[model samples]
Target chain A: TQLLEQSPQFLSIQEGENLTVYCNSSSVFSSLQWYRQEPGEGPVLLVTVVTGGEVKKLKRLTFQFGDARKDSSLHITAAQPGDTGLYLCAGYSGYSTLTFGKGTMLLVSP
Target chain B: DTAVSQTPKYLVTQMGNDKSIKCEQNLGHDTMYWYKQDSKKFLKIMFSYNNKELIINETVPNRFSPKSPDKAHLNLHINSLELGDSAVYFCASSLGTGLGQPQHFGDGTRLSIL
Candidate 1:
């Protein structure tokens, strides 16, 4: 079984604060994906990184895939209340399925 | 319009009862999947179907059965539900089985067992 470990299980910060969440695994993945899920809703894909050392930015959210494809990070700058949600990282290793991390619950207060 | 939709957003039932969750995707995708999210927010894949054909089954219990009526519809049925089966079930669809393809998800169905 492929397992993805996520750090900082829970986080709470005031508005405008910057935060970073991590996802790590011993097994290498062919691609990594970041998703955000709000309460009572399913996760929505934010970005997909297929290459190692690749970085993608969506406005204030930046996602990076590790050089070995064994880890990934999601950083949010000037996080607003809207950025509060569950952040999840999923990895695909040329298989028919994806391995998802436990997810990080972020609470941004204004 | 919701691209992917699941019925019975909230389901509460007894442990011995049986239930089913229905999912549909209007994006014309060829692949659909069912995932379970536990209380700790750990998501795991349970089943996948491509064009109404079962492709992947991740060691899920036989009590938990998945039926794909067509390419756009996938339904999950659980018999003799247990307390451990209580979780949020999400339905997702993708263009293909490739990991690179982005998946669209529906508002999950929250299943609560008593």
Candidate 2:
């Protein structure tokens, strides 16, 4: 079984602070995806990185896929109160399935 | 307009009761999936249906059955629900069963067993 390990299970930060969350695994994936889920809502796809060592920026959120395709990171710059949510990283291997990581809950306070 | 939607945003029921959750997507996607989110916020895929055909079935219990009546609708029926079954159920859809396809999700159904 493939397992995706995520770091910093919970984060509390003031507005305008920067934070980074990580997702690591021993198994390589074909693609990686990042999702942000707010309270009482389903997860929304933030970005999808397909190539190794790929980086995609969406507004203040930047996502990086590891060079080996076994890890990924999500960096948030100048986070605001609206950026507070649960961030999840999912890896897609063969067979058209996704292996999700335990999400990191972010609480940004103004 | 809501792209993907699930009914009964909140479900509170007694143990051993049978329940069903309905999902519909208007995005005209060809694939749909059901996922369960545990208390620790781990989202796990339970099943996947493409064009009303079952393509992926995880190690979920047989009591949890997913029915796709058509390409636009997929419903899940749980028989004899247990306390461990209490979790948030989300429905998602994508254009195809490809690796890089972006999945659109609906607001999850929060199920609680008493």
Candidate 3:
């Protein structure tokens, strides 16, 4: 079984602070995806990184796929209260369902 | 418009009771999936259907059956629900059974087995 380990399961920061969450795994994946879920709502896809050493930026959120394809990271710059949510990293193996991480819950306070 | 929607946003029932959660997607996608989110917030895939055909069935129990009557609908029926079955159930739709395609998700059905 492939396991995706995420760091800093819970995070709380003041506005304008920068935070980064990491997802690591021993098994390599074909692609990686990041999702952000708000309270009482389903997760919305933030970005999908397919190649190794790939980086995609969406507004203040930047996502990077590991060089080995076994890890990924989401960096948020100048976090705001609206950026508070559960950030999830999912790895796709191409053959089966995507493997999701335990998730990192971010609470940004203004 | 809601791309994916699940009915009964909250379900409270007792053990041994049979319940069903309905899901529908208007994205005209060919694949749909059922995922369970535990208390620790770990989302796990339980089953997936593509074009009304069962393609991926994880180690989910037989008591939990997923029926895809059509491409736009997938329903999950649980028989004799247990306390451990209490979790958030999410329905997602994808373009196909491949990687790279983003899966749109429903708000999730919060099931509580008493």
Candidate 4:
């Protein structure tokens, strides 16, 4: 069984602050995905990184895939109230199934 | 239009009762999945269907059954619900079944068992 471990289960910061969340796994994954979920709602796909050492940026959020494909990180620059939510990292093996991390709860106070 | 949709956004019932949650995707995808999120915000994959066939079945209990009528729809039927079953259920779909494709998710269904 593949397991993805995420660091800093909970985070709280003031507006305009910067924070980074990490997802690590012992097993290598074929791809990794980042999702953000608001209260009472399902997660929305923020980004997917397939290749090793890949990086993608969406507005104030930047996602990076580790060179070994066994880890990933999500960095939010100048976080705002809108950026506060549950951040999840899902790692997919060579197959179709995805192993999800415990997820990080971010709170950006204005 | 909603790419993926789940019915009965909220379900409240007593323990030992039976209920079902329906999901549909109009993204022309052939694979769909069911995920469960616990109170601590831990998400886990329950089941997955590809091309109307069961592809992945996690360690979920037999009380929870998943059925796919077609490529575009997957429904979850839970029998003899337990208090532990109270959680948010999400439905998602991808172009096929792989890592590169991004799976789109529907607004989850919140199930509460008393």
Count of clashing residue pairs in every prediction: 0, 0, 0, 0
Q: Candidate 2 residues B1-114, lDDT tens each? A: 999999989999999999999999999999999999998889999999999999999999999999998999999999999999999999999999988788899999999999
Model 4 spans with C-alpha error above 4 angstroms: none
lDDT of 2 by residue, A1-110 (tens): 79999989999999999999999999999999999999999999999999999999999999999999999999999999999999999989966798899999999999
**Overall lDDT per candidate, in order of appearance:** 0.94, 0.95, 0.94, 0.93
Q: Which candidate, 2 or 4, has the higher TM-score?
A: 2
- Ranked by lDDT, the better of candidates 3 and 4 is 3
Computed on C-alphas against the true complex, the DockQ of each candidate is: 0.79, 0.84, 0.79, 0.80
Cα deviation of A98 in candidate 2 (Å)?
Answer: 1.0
Docking class of 2: high
TM-score of each: 0.98, 0.98, 0.99, 0.97
Candidate 1 regions with alpha-carbon error over 4 angstroms: none
Candidate ranking under DockQ, highest first, comes to: 2, 4, 3, 1
Error of 2 at B45 (Å): 0.4
Binned by DockQ into CAPRI classes (incorrect, acceptable, medium, high), candidate 3 is medium
Best by DockQ: 2
Worst 10 residues of 4 chain B by lDDT: B96-105
Whose DockQ is higher: candidate 1's or candidate 2's? 2
